[model samples]
Target: MKNSIFNTILVTLSVSLLLLLGGCAKTIVPPTDTSAMATGSDLEYPESHNTGTMGEAGFSEDNLPLEGSLDDNSHSFNDTDIMNMPEAFRREHGRSSEGFLPVYFEFDQFRLSPEMMVVIEQNAAYMQSNPAINLILEGNCDERGTAEYNLALAERRAINVKRYLTNTGIPENHIRTISYGEERPLFLGHDEKAYKYNRRVDFIAE
Candidate 1:
């Protein structure tokens, strides 16, 4: 009876020790990936994010309360419609109604005369000051040559003026060329005085 009692006590002690060791093992082992169980309160990147699918964070011009609306063009400007704009608005946008002085050429010649070069220089100075000015170089010729030949000459006249302006620091794109040839004469008479006035390039501001 004493031996059986001692054996039973030993068996009881072994079972209690095994149970305590199993509990300690569970408490000591840590999770492999802590991020997997994160609640995302202090996480660098959230497990799931809503990227403004229903306007939660996305930005759109249509949805924003902008100071100006697309239909409100009172503050906007169109370069092509500049001529129709009011004088005040035109001045505000760096435009002027002042005309550029015309540059005359010799009869049937597209080359710039020394005097004509002086005129072009002055024009370039004006253009430099008002860099926003758009120019239309209208080339005219005396009623001397055939329509085709005069038209070609007129184009050369306009191109020459354009080249001179561009060389003087004016942007080439700001100047446009149009050839009237001998069709639109400044002086209708068939005299040397009339021909002299007709052979010219007139600058129109837009």
Candidate 2:
């Protein structure tokens, strides 16, 4: 009978030990679902995304200047509009006497001559009167040099004309420049008459 009682007490002690060990055991919480946490508070978004603008990556159309907005003078001519420009202004080689006179340059020179400066001043005056008109400075060159060299020279001529116009209170962005080089000559010949008409910057109004 004593042995039986001792066995019962031993079983009770074993049960108590098991319960104490279970109470002290650490709880395994399935690693806290770190994958969802990684995508939540720690996720980084692009600047455009944060602003809720519609565009891929960081490019947003809201940042672009509005069309016909004169405040910034941000206007651009598409290829179709350029193609529809007057043939006389596009390729005809001649001096304009009245409105938007062509600014002539010396052979292989991009500097604005005193006479050319006067022409630019007149053009600037015209632009000041019509603030909404956009201008295109088309630089040309005689067909005497390599196409590449003439193209670069023509570009310089256009830029110089643009600089002069900007100094005269015209918005810099209102003027667009293009170099025709020897591709579009008013006079199509090897003589000075042809070269004289070809080496000029023509103003096209839009």
Q: Stretches of candidate 2 above 4 Å error?
A: 1-98
Predicted model with the maximum TM-score: 2
Task: Find the number of clashing residue pairs for candidate 2.
Answer: 1
Tens digits of per-residue lDDT for model 1, 25-51 = 743221122221212121222224311
Task: Give residue 68's lDDT in candidate 2 (0 to 100).
Answer: 20
Deviation in angstroms for 47 in model 2? 45
Clashing pairs in 1: none
Instruction: Give Cα-based local distance difference scores for all models.
Output: 0.59, 0.62
How much does each candidate deviate from the true structure in C-alpha RMSD?
A: 33.3, 25.8
Summarize candidate 2's per-residue lDDT along 1-206 as a digit string, tens digits. 99999999999999999999999987432111112111111122233322211122211223322122113231233435544656565444243323577887766556566666777898999899989887877777788666655666676667767877897899998987777778766665789866777888878776
Query: In model 1, where is the ten-residue run with the lowest total lDDT?
Result: 51-60
What's the TM-score of each model vs. the native? 0.53, 0.54
